[model samples]
Target: MRQHSTSTHLAQKSSWTHPIYTKKQILDVQTAHRKASSWQDRVALSTVKVLRWGMDFVTGYGTYSPISISVPKTRTMTEQKWLTRFIFLESVAGVPGMVAGMLRHLKSIRMMRRDHGWIETLLEEAYNERMHLLTFLKLAEPTWTMRCMVLGAQWVFFSGFSLAYLISPQICHRFVGYLEEEAVITYSKAIKDFDDGHLPLWEKLEAPEMAIKYWQMPENNRCMRSLLLYVRADEANHRDVNHTLGNLNQTDPNPFAAKPKIEIGLPQLQQNGRVKD
Candidate 1:
């Protein structure tokens, strides 16, 4: 039996069974995918920001300060800066779903009524966000200070979202929807920066092993930009789902069914991944 050379294997792997794209193509698609296309879309996005601002005001001193200090300017968010942002961002991101799920579970038990599948879905969302945190853990080790910040941020956000969820789940869900919208924008910028020659570090970086496993990304096609795209798509799905829930009446059919699927095409590159747009 003839042994194949490494280049032979790699060439075979890189053969385009699917459409391959350049960095520009992926970035263009992501921007287009997340763009708010119409007047109503624009208004709704503005409203989300305003509502989130109000919510942030309630705990702004605590939550906003850490974010402001941690996340660098978009052009400056190199791998380390972005990973630091993810450490804190993901810690807080995992909170709302767990709090909402736990509260819904108790509400259902006390009322002796089924929870309309909310408990399971919310718990799943929580777990997914936790997975995001875990994936980032493989990419960056937080300093002791960053670890303390994560602990502090999680405690405050958990308390705030829990109370808000208990008082008015609509606001709680809307808050998360808005948060996810911001996440979508953040990831898109990261991808753009990397593609545009700003994040030189990305050229030398491989996608985290956990990210590849979680997204079922091709092993031969793994890069930091691909991971960002996948994670952004996840956030976009969460954004749409929570927004739909916020707009619904309690009797709405199949809330879980309303969530949008991710839909971003992955490049057939040496290190790229696919995301459901």
Candidate 2:
């Protein structure tokens, strides 16, 4: 029985293995904004703006300005503050994907029709965001106040997003696209802070073990800056993906449904033949 249990554990692997990123790919990631062309797009962008404003206000994060603006910066966020903001951002970010996937799954079942590859992609996105939150949790533990805030925000956002998705999935996708744009910008600023010698601790800090394994980061690129680069690239991909999804009809097939080259295989084993974490 013990041997059978051990074999079962060794066979288990993540359903959604994260994509491996090249250094060039990570570094080349840039913040992009999609223009709102229709009423749905406008409404999505507007809602994201309001939410961003509220989140920034509550987290004590200042408004972002263009890099070309030559103005003296007064506020500098500490490492802890950045972590706090990240925790909140990721906590909320993981919700939309799950809600969309769940609703589509139910609809598929009720209508006796396939979801045309959307359900898997949405669930994978949610899993990726959860990994991001776990990586940050390794860096900083949230306070009870923050926990309570996350609880309240999740409940409200989940309910609202569900209703919105039911009414119009296109708008929901556009909203998520805009939200990912903001995420890319936030991570870019953090990377800039690291580059400018502001985040001294991050300069010397290595990414969490989970992050290193998940991203398949190279030995030399396992630092905090590399982690941000990886995350920023992911947000950029998400931004583009959702914008594209927003433009498609509900019955259309997902364009980004290509399977990964690598399939789930045997777990990495230690020298003693036990599965490695």
Q: Which 10-residue span in candidate 2 carries the lowest summed lDDT?
A: 1-10
Q: State the lDDT of candidate 2 residue by residue for 56-94, as single tens digits.
A: 877878533446433335445668778889999999999
Write out the backbone clash pairs for model 1: 221-271, 221-272, 222-271, 262-276, 262-277, 263-276, 263-277, 264-277
Stretches off by above 4 angstroms in model 2 are 1-12, 63-75, 259-277
Global CA lDDT computed for model 1 = 0.63
Q: Which structure among the candidates has the greatest lDDT?
A: 2
lDDT of 1 by residue, 1-277 (tens): 1111212112222111222444444444342223544454455467557744643342221121223444334334556767777667788889888898898888888999876556767877888888789778876778887788778767877787777677777666666776787777667766766776667877767766555556666665577778787777778778877876665544333345323311111122112321122
**Local distance difference test, each candidate:** 0.63, 0.82
lDDT of model 1 at residue 136? 80
Candidate 2, 72: how far from true, in Å? 10
For model 1, give the 10-residue run with minimal summed lDDT.
261-270
Evaluated at residue 251, the lDDT of candidate 2 is 74
**If scored against the real structure, what TM-score would every candidate get?**
0.68, 0.86
Best by TM-score: 2
TM-score for candidate 2: 0.86
